[model samples]
Target chain A: MSTPTETDAFEVDDSSIERMRFYGRLFLGACIVATLVGIVALIALVFDVVVEAWGWLTWEFLTHPPSYLAEHYDPSNYGDLPTGPGGIYPAIVGSIYLIAMTAVFTLVLGVGAAIYLEEYARDTKLTSFIEANIANLAGVPSIVYGLLGLALFVRAMGAGSSLLAGALTLTLLILPIVIVQTQEALRAVPDSMRQASYGTGATKWQTIRNVVLPEAIPGIMTGIILSLSRAIGETAPIIMVGAATSMFAPPNLTDPTGSFAAMPMQIFEWAKAPEDDFQHIAAAGIIVLLTVLLLMNAVAIYIRNKYDR
Target chain B: MTANGPQTVTTSESDGATSDDAMTDDAPLGSPRVDDAVIESRDLDVYYGDDQALHGINMDIPERKVTALIGPSGCGKSTFLRSINRMNDLIDIARVEGDLYFHGKNVYDEDVDPVALRRKIGMVFQKPNPFPKSIFDNVAYGLRVQGKDDGDVEEKVRTALERAALLDEVEDQLDSSGLDLSGGQQQRLCIARAIAPDPEVILMDEPASALDPVATSKIEDLVEELAEEYTVVIVTHNMQQAARISDKTAVFLTGGHLVEFDDTNKIFENPESDRVEDYITGKFG
Candidate 1:
């Protein structure tokens, strides 16, 4: 009524609009920088490792063992034949052995505990306390597991610094992960499904075995794959439990119980050496480790995509 | 909607005539009990925690008969149906009192197992909940849980699907996921799953409520056919559906009290209780 003025119709403030744009740009810019940092770091690591190990990624380097004599060592020399110094055959075999043992032991212990906790154990004060303690154990340092393995399995248990000791330590280290993952998998199954099974005259154990486990298998497998990848890359525990890098070749399926050298321990030993050749071999070892981890993660991703729906 | 006195019908005890033949053509099939009774519940009461859902309810459910329970929202018709199979025991807070007899056996006995009870008495829910498996596997689930692994599972699954009136549509897509089916098809698949184990009694809690008119008619026909073998008890909100399908009708009021139960036609045209009459007439629910 005072006066139909144009400024009265337009009360928008330009400064506030500019402030909003400023925050939006700040957020977007921060995200872009963080993403670039991750990509650049990954590319740099890949380039450095690939360049260093280019000289050592030959068939000879893969098929022979580390030589004891310097005259015949020939670290950089690939002789006439396809064979050469320092084949990772022992380390590969040993890593597989360690991983298998870790898987079996961890699955048995972890899934068993999970089943008891989720399906059977009463959710009382004691059970809650135990659950909290297990979650806390997951955050404990990996090196602390190594020290524990040395104290318990090696000295007290008289297992020595053998593959068994290393396997046991790695198993304990990943047991918490498996337990947590298994619980999550079990929990993901709908309560109605369980009721349906029970309503069909199936007993409690029968319901868990037939219905619940089948539904949770994919999730459990994904957890197992991820855990195995971490266990394969674990060095501190194995080193603490005395996995020697000097071992030529340790064991196979037929002799699965025998002691062996693992890839991480071998890489650690080679990386500590001052020679440039040893560094190249260490880089190659790292590449192999990365390959295994990549394969495991790929399998996990494939399984998760296939069945998590 | 004032309360009217009970209209006492002076029909003879021997008069077994149904009030309307249009809806009562599909009579259930079971061993003809010279004394016609399948389930007998006496002074039944259902409680959830401290709250009582159903008061004392006494009724005789005839074998191989379609008995429809109708009520307004929050009525205890579903609760009454669940009590027959002891399905209420599944709820942690639920408590049941008095006696429910199935084939003359006390379902609430100390030694009685709810799982065993449910095996004889299967149930279908309002919403379709087919397992996230192939159509064949979904039907075979009930049998599989019973350890029927003779490889004749396929034949039984087909038979059940056929009985549920879904075989013609899904026969070609046996391997397809059950969830891929339309809502009505999925509901029929659930019905097939329920009947696959050859349960003696099938309890449907608003089985057709989620379906459209066409799908509802299909289910109604399917239920009629199923009555030839399995004793059927259906809970529905649609009074017309109850009149169209059920031989016997039970009307429950607020607080889970059974107000009237009689022939479906009688309950609709000339209900014994004023409350039931008012409910059916749309004066009150």
Candidate 2:
């Protein structure tokens, strides 16, 4: 038998190897370009908003309520802050109230629903139908949910154009998203953990409370916070639920029926004003909204880092 | 022991009700019973949906001894082990039939709560699955679940860790996460967790198969030591490991059949069935 040469035993086609390398580089280049497109657009938008907001954005702008004569408003009469049109203070307060209420409702209802579906409910046709509907609801138009809130909460339920109606509306808009994301979080928990808990003779509830939920909490919190950030920036739903564009006082948290003004609605009003100064004020409002969003995302990331094992 | 029918007949003649009551009241560990058998299965069958996994498995697992079930993959050795503790009930499609009796009481009876049954019969799995908690919490979990960890939990946890032969390595860092430990240490931690409840029986399904040779030997030694107090029912794919540790060995072949069960020395040296001898010689699985 003839022995093969070493080169013949281990041969490489240089041209083919070079061609493969070229294709890999081309794919990597395309991916980089795709990523850069999103980053560049976001930077450009933020830069423009900050430049426009530079003169209008002030400490007083954050502390005073909206006014029709905001362009000529003076800061010397700080005692008359409620009547002053120097800032979007009431709108900021309204946004905080709205999100706080939304957070409590979503955490209770969304997390509860997710736990039931993931842990207790069997894979029956009815459950599948509900799961499918939730997925579809997440993709439904925000304006449609606005219409839902208008008809269900604002009119039929007698909540009127109040903070209660607006909060409930925002909750309805983001509830499906929260539920879907929370279920994903729960599903990400390893099945082996459940088995380990059960092997120790833990009942279903004990397993969930002690092992499953604690492990899934980080993911769940991240999902809920992200969904709330989206809800905070929502304009169309609050509009349909009748949030005021401008208000003299902050929202009355004690009374659900009191009128409120959210940042997005306030910005929308300013952006639509005849004077270009109000347009800059709208840009300032956008800056504040973006800051709040960034802060919320930071909290989400911190929670994920702290609890992830 | 060679004939299965006579053993079942004689065991059934005894009054089951009184024995069951006595078994429940007695402490699971170090109990002296009239009968030597801790678990007995009569014509036990298991199925996953339409496909059967175990067929008419009959065996009497002796008390306070290591009983090893040896079989190839898909031969239902693990299935039989899970059936002993009713762990297979977790699978939605899996079903059990006939009788699996623990201390003379049929575990499948309507009145039998699987949660309570599992407290008496703890299990370890093919992989070391320590919870993402501190070592102390992981060991204390079984007791805490049963609301039995009132004050002596720390002492019980320490004793369990010592029994599993992991205390020396992990004692200084008892508050550290169990996941931070090595694979062998994690498996030992899992063994500690299972035995923390002071169960009468410990079911292990390929417990050391995932570990290295050193870890495997450690687990083997630990299993032998555990058998002195707890009845260790182990399922292993390694033939030599079964021969080295088990008091009695049950050979399960393909198609979920229990071909032969006898003393470990007899099964390895002079088995009756031709297939059993062929399997022992590594001719076929």
Candidate 3:
């Protein structure tokens, strides 16, 4: 008279659950292995770079002028300046100017594009096309961006072969990356937050500025750091944009017309020399570059944790 | 209104196909009079994309009182409530037709700004959602955005928290992150946020659905008190909450139909519609 389940007083079986235990452990082990692989490689690379550059990392090496001849620039044999006065002061100054200039324009353009794509843009063909192009642009080679900088910033805009030209090219190369990341950061904000803001009667702009932007600050900052880091170390793009390999006097940082020498350009030039000392100086320059990059990422991580908590 | 049968919208007919019949129109059932009403909906219909979620909703929400909308899941109870504050406008595909009158102004009027309307009618969601900020800043956010600049933010926040009955608990930790508070405390903090703007109406979407029994009772008690000062329209799946806190109760059924609405006692004691009786008696969802 009773149903099958009721008559049997249905006992729940635990036999089938045993496989989940095995599978879960397997997945966990797989994830750990993947993480260890990345960590080990990163540790090894950092250790190698620090070891090669640590001995050459002196105070004078950091603050001295380049030893290359400006008029008779020879790569194979150095005449008066074989080892070169080898401080990267001018390169450091030039790189800082490029970073600052790139940031000023890229942030304004990138964040705006992201907000439009995420918030305002309708799902039409044009928007989708633009979004697709942005994704593609992020994957475009850095050298092509350098060429773009030459044709547009150097020729069309008359910026010439200066820090402005290099900075502008680098900005073009990283714009797509910034837009994509900023959009992701904006998207990560829960719709509930926007609803809560609107429920309080805030306007669209008001909600974005007050609620959306504050919550997305961590993600936005991470994107900015990542893009700037890429822009700061680039060699081919800067070289194509007419960045000089060596300049004895510090380049006019503010003037867009003056010639420039970035750390990568200087390092590339020195490392090309036959003398071993030039290689040491180049490695030291690399150490400085890595330190600058690490500091930027540290600042980003600190800001993210402060707000994320 | 049919006593047992629940009317549903059919795809064959266009808009204006459903009956405008009112079941609770019997003396003092809907309201004492229209003068006491703050918000009124006439033949309100809501559509999400091509699908209709609410049909022919006509009701007068009394001023300074809590009116609860109760029904089974996806019965358009929340949809109807969101329509009142024009919160549905936030959805890209949601469309609301018919007039939603708020104190004689059509909320959907071309000239009416949705932003301005929202400030007057605040909402607290089913889940407690506070900004990632200090308790004081969370409450002060709406005021600051309104450009109050009056330096009386601390005083206003205290008054609001006191009204929401969370002042004593959170007063000492005003500087602490709202996220750090317990779930119940965060829900209360959201209520305080809604009240800080001095809204004339408050819409609560199952405001205590995520809370424990004690917290649920606390929110129920807060709703009863809030009805004295603001027109509170709430959507809750819990009938007991509707009976306990609401001055009036509207029963939504399948096909986005409002089967019955009346004074809280009549709807519970002797529903005009048989479906309302069945729903109240747990006959069927």
Per-candidate chain B TM: 0.88, 0.88, 0.91
What residue runs in model 1 are displaced by over 4 Å at the alpha carbon?
A1-22, A67-75, A80-84, A122-126, A252-257, B1-35, B149-152, B253-259, B270-285
On the 0 to 100 scale, the lDDT of residue B185 in model 1 is: 95
Candidate 1, position A110, lDDT: 90
**Count of clashing residue pairs in every prediction:** 2, 1, 3
State, as a TM-score between 0 and 1, how close model 3 is to the true structure: 0.88
What TM value does model 2 have? 0.91
DockQ of each: 0.34, 0.73, 0.65
- Cα distance off (Å), candidate 1, residue B73: 4.2
Docking class of 1: acceptable
lDDT by residue for model 2 (B62-106), tens = 999999999788989999999998999999889998788898899
- Tens-place lDDT per residue, model 1, A27-55, is 99999999999999999999999998886
Report how closely model 2 matches the true complex, as a DockQ value: 0.73
Ranking by TM-score: 2, 3, 1
Worst 10 residues of 1 chain A by lDDT: A67-76
- Tens-digit per-residue lDDT, A26-92, candidate 2: 9999999999999999999999999988877878889887888755434445556555547889999
lDDT per residue (tens digit) for residues B28-71 in model 1? 11111224668876567789989988765656688898989899
In model 3, what lDDT does residue A241 have? 87
Descending-lDDT candidate ranking: 2, 3, 1
DockQ of model 1 vs. true complex:
0.34
